[model samples]
Target: MRPRFITLEGVDGAGKSTHLGFIRATLLTLGIDACFTREPGGTRLGERLRELLLAVETEVSLETETLLMFAARQQHLAEVIRPALVAGRWVVSDRFTDATFAYQGGGRGVANARIAVLEDWVQQGLQPDLTLLFDVPTEVAAQRMAATRELDRFEREEGDFHRRVRAAYLARAADNPRFYVLDSTRSIADIQSDIAQRLAQLAEQP
Candidate 1:
């Protein structure tokens, strides 16, 4: 049996990481061997790349940022994700390629063509079997983020940029049947219930 590749994605403060723990617990209860990981820091090389990408003092161009993300992703896939999936261990990720498309392409106004090229080169047609997109209004997400940790480079962008990223995510969800978009403004327990229900449904599918 092939293991499931699941990814959760959303703008900052959408509570993705919070839900990951719940999802992992649920999977364990079902007797599934699941592994949790996050992009840009899943491996040693990836962690270094993550620091460069998120560091407040470092200046990087849009193209440079995109390429570095892919570099980290490649190492993450080779070292952590692919092997686990091949061994029939469920792999859950906090974010994936969708984040790059949202932040770099949509928010930064990078060309879609350029983004697609890098994605293809790095992913080599790999995709998550299921993608749960936590959807929320830009303002709601921003306010939540502000209340939490200090802003990262991407999180410090203007409201309009985040709006564009949200729009892009919606468009991507529309085109992809594997995507499950959920209203993230709900309570954590409610969101966890919804996720468990969705996972059960997926498990039942032929």
Candidate 2:
């Protein structure tokens, strides 16, 4: 099997973090050398930016946030993701460019065209081979997020913001062939089962 980049995306508390291990184990069982990483913190410089970005006390402009995101992404791609793929390992990332489209583009009202230009400049032709999008109702996601340790800047946004983010995510999924949208309202076992089936199908592909 060719080394492939996979990303798991969703609104916060949609349960993507919970299933990452299962996804990795399943990939390993399929004989893939899978390695897991996350956006905004995959590299050293990225990790520092991650703290600044997520801090509730920090206020950032939309353009500043978007630029910082791509800056971290450039470092992540060069220092972590690309090297892992080059070493014949499958890369599984928690979030990627799609989150930018949703968070900055939808939630923050940044223009999509602006993000597109940055994406082209930073990522060039690189894109995830598969993207698993965990979908959930806004209320459900909010309820789950309420129990988390602390709300980050993005997580502290109001209901209207989250709705826009979800819409943006779905819109992007609709336009992309590599995305698999999973309804997170289902049981975890059922979700994993479906993911397993998808993995099997992917494994059979050339």
Candidate 3:
């Protein structure tokens, strides 16, 4: 089978980080040689850009922020993702282009068409074979963040902003068969059961 590309996406505090290890372990058990990485930081240059993007003290205009994200993604694809896939490794990213659509387009009000143009130019026709979207109410996500690590610039945004981000994610999932939206308000056991089922199904695909 050709190496499959998978992405995990959600608004901040949606518990994607919590479930990553399980996915990695499950794929390992399934005998998939997967290369797991995250967006905005997979490549050396991209990690530097990630620090700038997430640092609360850093200042950037919305358009500049969007461009920088794609710039990092371009490097990530060229240096990490594409190469790994070509070498017969299944590629799994923590976040990918859908994140830009949610955070930049839906939350910050960049037009979807504008983001689409960059997506086409940067990714060519490449897209995740499966995108697992872990969704939750903004209130739930905020509480999770507060009880855990320090908030990043994006995570520091207000509730309404996250609502818009969640909406954008669902919108994408609705249009694309590749997306599997998981209701993250449920218990971890329940969520992982669903995820394992889906991953098993994906393992069977060509």
Off by over 4 Å in 3: none
TM-scores for every predicted model: 0.96, 0.98, 0.98
Writing each residue's lDDT as its tens digit, candidate 1 over 105-147 gives 8888888889899889888888999999999999999999999
Per-residue accuracy of model 2 over 140-164 as CA lDDT, tens digit each: 9999999875789889999999999
Report, for all candidates in order, the number of backbone clashes: 0, 0, 0
Q: Worst lDDT window (10 residues) for model 3?
A: 25-34
Worst 10 residues of 1 by lDDT: 197-206
RMSD of each: 1.1, 0.8, 0.7
Please provide, for model 3 over 79-158, each residue's C-alpha lDDT reduced to its tens digit, 9 standing for 90 to 100. 99999989989999999999999999999999999999999999999999999999999999999999998999999998
Best by lDDT: 3
Ranking by lDDT: 3, 2, 1
Each model's lDDT: 0.88, 0.93, 0.95
Pull out the clashing pairs in model 3. Answer: none
